[model samples]
Target: MKKTMKTTTPITKTLAAAGLAGILMISASGLPSAHVHAETKAAASTNRVTAPTVAPQLVTSKTLQSKEKWLETNIKIPVFQGLTDTKYQDQLNDIIESHASKDMDKWEKEAAEAAANAQKNGYTMHPYQLTINYELTSDGKDDSLISLKVITEGIGMNNGDPRVDTYNFTNEVEAQRVTLEDLFGKDYKSIVDKAVKTAIAADQDQYFANEDGFQSIDAEQSFYVADGKAYIVFQKYSIAPGSTGTPEFAIKLPGKGSDKKPAAAVVKSGAYYKDKNGKIMVQVSVLRQLQFNVKWNGKSKTTEISKGAVWSAVKLNKDAYTLGKMAPRSLGSAPVMKKGHIYVPLAFLTDVLNLNADHSKHGQITVTAAK
Candidate 1:
């Protein structure tokens, strides 16, 4: 019989939940071999005994600070114990440490430049900051496998871009890096491509135009496994606006997506036309297919769509819409009354519902779920 296992917990989420601020980065010893098989044999019988788990440890480095440059650094590097092959462990640590050091050096110079510029220009500046943190996402039983993320964040400098490096290793005589193909087979790209497109289509407002923003995952794309699922990660602003930060797409492989079926497609059509601003305006009734209850208050000249606890109301001829308890945001275009029926922008309505529009196929619009 075949067997597979993976586990991980991202520390960023934990810190965020605790209301801790600042970003993280990691460094390691060296790079290991580039080849690692994804499969391992199970015991002959289910009753076979197993040994106690030997987990990896996090070793904190001495905090480094430069008062003149207004910069400070903090890092936590990983160390593996009791492994027959410690080469990979050491190399992983090296990689994390090296990355953190390089980043700090680069940011330190930039911070100094910013400080001089601020002094010359007679202005105050925020102090430069750097932090490196790691998330030990998963360690297979008996130390068969190890997976983790090296998170790096820089602040108050010239383009302190956030970065995450994923490392997957096999605890054997020789350590090897795990590739996407090893995790999901040869058709990995197709699976990831579909998920990426689906995600962008679902959240159109968050991403730039698809044609220019993202095409597909590269052969050496960064990824990590956690909680029985794999996540494909893109750098900040690579596929979306800066507000989106780093974009991640979660995909379940055969062991993942096989059990659950895709959501049924919902199709609906209404008279649509390009407005003066070139926005697609459709009949308000189309929202019904999205499971939104539309109501019109003739006296107040308002239209409201409610679904459970989430509700949005917009006044006729107004370019603002109230979503639940949040402040009003622009609808881009105001809803208008045409022949006693309400018409709204297709983009606005679909965005509010968190769905995507597909005009590639039939004349009708097909809505799909987003991340």
Candidate 2:
């Protein structure tokens, strides 16, 4: 987002809001709003996971003075302690330094050009500034995953959108870079597309329409993993108005909290019965509790389930079902029609939709939508 610089003084503190001269503000604690999660005391005891904390050290600071221009630069790098493999740390340092050096040079050139113009036109010039700061998203201690968000802000002739570069690394000896597919598997693209679209759907008016809005996340989309979720980030004005800042959607990461016992379903009232095959069959309408829209087509005798960009189709007495454009897979048991309602195998939730379908001792099925 665009952060305005007030006057020409050196910026020593993180940005805050005021008026046109206000700059982007980060939390005083350096924790992003996206990382905040609330859990009950009982649940916290059962599933306790803490992110690694690292200290940041100021590495570069420079200032330039001239008759008509004043410029300042600041850069800080994170310091990792008790690390066996230093490749990840070394790589991140190099990348941040490289970016800072390039930006400093560019800002210097822009300042000189601006100063010359001010002298000729007899107008005062504002200070030219560049600053690079970082927030630690993840460290490799607990999950062998390291991620960081590096923020760069420049102020000279105009206010520009902050450039954020996210670095994700696997804590291997060689320090391999992590990709969306590596984190979410083969269906990474589809999974991200559905999650982003669903988040945007929450307020479509906040974003642009047609082609100018979001089309799809690229294979190399910007992301960072934190709090058992991978967040997909969009640049300012890329998909929405600047007032929205940088939009990010959190996708539940695979295998997160799997070791811990599944929490009780928040809302667990659904009609389900066990068929002769012993497979739990749930009424198609029950999916509504999990935020799925179910539609019945009498002309084609098909049932469609949709959530944002993801959809699934199944037909009566059909042994197969299709999810999105993927090939059809056997449902193990075809949908059963009874009492003017359609009941599909529990696999419809656990297998096809990738939801959590847990059976309690009392014959009730606990359905939980993926976060």
Candidate 1, 1-371: lDDT as tens digits = 11121233322221100001112122221111111112111111112111122233322222334444467665554444544346545655455555555666777778788888899999998878877665555554312345666667777765667766766654434444555655554456776677677766666666789476888887667766555456566767677777766666656644443453233233335467778988877766445433355665656877677756768887778888667887777767998877655778876656775667777455666555464
Q: Whole-model lDDT, candidate 1?
A: 0.55
Q: Flag regions of model 1 displaced more than 4 Å.
A: 1-69, 256-371
Worst 10 residues of 1 by lDDT: 14-23
Measured against the true structure, the TM-scores of the candidates, in listed sequence, are 0.52, 0.53
lDDT of each: 0.55, 0.58
Cα misplacement distance, residue 15 of candidate 2 (Å): 13
Evaluated at residue 169, the lDDT of candidate 1 is: 51
lDDT of 1 at 312: 83
